[model samples]
Target: MASSSSSSSSLNFTVRRCEPELVPPAIPTPHEVKLLSDIDDQDGLRFHVPMVQIYRKKESMAEKDPVQVIRQALSQTLVFYYPFAGRLREGPHRKLMVDCTGEGVMFIEADADVTLDQFGDSLQPPFPCYQELQYEVPGSQEITNTPLLLVQVTRLKCGGFFLAIRLNHTMCDGPGYQQFLSAWAEMARGATKPSIAPVWRRELLMARDPPRITCNHREYEQVPDTVKGTVTPNQDDMVQRSFFFGPLDIAALRRLIPQHLRHCTTFDLITACLWRCRTKALQIEADEDVRMMCVVNARGQFNSPLPVGYYGNGFAYPAAVTTAGKLCGKPFGYAVELINKVKGEMTEEYLQSVADLMVMKGRCLFTTVRSCIVSHLARFNIREVDFGWGEGVYAGVAQAGGGSFPGISFFCSAKNGKGEEGIVFPICLPAAAMERFSQEFNHMLRNKNQPQTTSATLIMSNL
Candidate 1:
């Protein structure tokens, strides 16, 4: 099958192999195993995170076939991360486990007729037929029958290519998926061993006794099994936009904060600014309780810490909550302090207590409409995944139209040809509110001396 747009075109290439294989071929039988931790158990349901990477052509890679190399490396890399090649199944006690059946990942090859330059500068506000770049699987199928991972490598007319990957969130989190990509790239470079060897120790995160409930976990409230009188919004009115925050832009925002709070991390400041702007854009009620939900990595929080390559969901969703009036009306430092306090609360005991509480309740915590979920991908070196080609010109998550939640944002580190450091924010909002959001966000960044708005509105529209 093939799909095309005015700027870019793609043709799907048939794949030959789909069975998982072990490189060494000496390990024990790949039997079905239970996911020991409740953290993994809660997310075992089928949900996928899609990512796309756009790489400019390297002259040396012009003649080499990327498809063959990627396929070979993927096959070898699966020997270590073999669970990715397996299926999700309901184990005893209604828990989800991996059916390690050696069923391989879905791999597809594609060709794009457009040059990299013609494909537009931002991967957000995705081009028409962007869905063609991502591998597709039937949505109605049982979770056990679906492939855990799907990859599509599209070669462009300019010799550059786009690599799109969709991984089942039930099987791994962001860090885990990055590890798999890094390992595969290493194999593609003909390295015998990956830089970090993977460790499967899910038992280490087992739930504690008596289900300890410590500090107020207001961020993670349980949803009732049934609901009535809930209204659904019009999905068609939603729009996804990407904003670029250059080094200078970020520094300006930092300068606005008090000197005492200046020591806050970049993630802290950027997220604080976004939370305030997003809340204002929605024109939410002053008294409405709003939240900034962030996914915290628990790997390093534990006393011993998880193994470097423990591939599972080792993260916690910690949120900072305040009424809209308080959050927007307060100084920027207030939000930063709230976020920092939440970060400090993610100690080993807190995580253990959370796991215990989840086990006792038999349900995962849920979010509400007032919550703005923010994920930071700046730390992950996704741009460094080199498979014969030079580093990618741009790489980030794939954002589809119409399915966007009102206040979700992802921050990523980006660089252009000039090597300037920049942060890219992919934000989703109701189409009607985008203009107002652009105005407010830009105003927050403007200097007090500047009498007028700069090119912020123009930049936002182009996004």
Candidate 2:
């Protein structure tokens, strides 16, 4: 094992690359092929998703070295997910493709000198400490040189361990990647085969012709092109916070909406509250059109749903746009209506139309300064991943860097050491706006006469 020390007093770790093992047998012909769908082409070329999960000490895990178990399972799992061991190459048409050269995924082993409790309750630590746990692939900007996935395992002094993962978004979406992780965990637990085998039929998402524009696509047109140049606040001027909402809080939000809309799902209600609070926090011009960009899974929206194991970008980007003043001034039900309207509009024809539009434009939709992107992961089996040690105490997405666009939040399930059920929001905002956002968010929870919000606050304060 390799070790390095950190300057921070909180946590320190040393990292070293583990020996690489190729998955498939070497052959004269390499598995080189283009991606199934061009939808991924619109994604930022160099952007990757980073996640960290902490597993507390367990007797079963302590008896067997977690590193060895993870290594053995990962190597075996890659046999099926071989494309992860390959490099990204440009096809003849300048599109990206996976060149299955069997270079192998990057694996790093680290020794953390701190205990799990000492690392704190929030899974996300400061960037310095968090970055060390994740493996950074060299030459990440160069497609051909970058590995599709990187894994880091850090063993803590308390017997607990942290698994940091970095995966190229171009290769797969959240659900697809989660499936891979779940399968790997199953292997680590000694399963001979994964319960769900991944299917790589990307061509199934290809666009159709006549370029149908079946409903209004004003959402895409509403996104400003100048968003790429929008300024990001300095790290010192930014604050990241996590807020939890229990069943009571959710019910209260539903009550705020009209009876007609009360039937909306819990996700719709919570997202509406977030949109309203965030809009108020920013205090943008009343006339300014603020939008909430949401990612909708398109797998089941098709007339004939995609396979359960379909590992591709089976998602759509839909936005709910309204003036900041309208959002802040209207009753909570208004925001819910806007969101539900967009959700309801996502029919089979609508999704197909969006695909056709993207194919025609040869680009992906972009968000603007007025846009706040939100992702819901509460339904994903994030807390269910077990590597023989036990279920993770905390598992969620980690920020890529210190700075990010003003408003980005991920809603996931929360396990606060207690047997309570709640939803947690990992949010990033400008420091100047966090205080107000927190106040507004808490106000809604407390006004619901919910006691769980108090517990949620205590949990966050400990972090």
* lDDT (Cα atoms) of all candidates against the true structure: 0.67, 0.69
Look at candidate 1 and give me any clashing residue pairs.
none
Q: Model 1, which residues run further than 4 Å from truth?
A: 1-29, 43-46, 124-128, 140-144, 222-234, 400-406, 416-419, 450-463
lDDT of 2 by residue, 283-370 (tens): 7778778778777777777778888998777776678888888998988889988887787666667666776766666554455566
Position 274, candidate 1: lDDT: 81
Give the per-residue lDDT digits (tens) of candidate 1, residues 1-463: 5444432233223222223222221233376665747777663224566777777788877777777778788888877777777777776555677877776777777776666666455444344356666646455134555777778888777778778887676677778877888898998889876899988788776686656777567667643322221112354565556777766667767777788887788888888888888778878778777778776778877779998888787876677888889988988788877876777767777777667766776746445556766777767878777877868777767762222343456676676334566777766666667677787788788888644433221222222
What TM-score does each of the candidates earn? 0.87, 0.87
**Candidate 1 TM-score, true structure as reference:** 0.87
How big is the positional error of residue 132 in model 1, measured in Å on the Cα after superposition?
1.2
Q: Which stretches of candidate 2 lie over 4 Å from their true place?
A: 1-4, 7-30, 44-46, 92-94, 124-128, 141-144, 210-213, 222-236, 400-406, 417-419, 448-453, 458-463
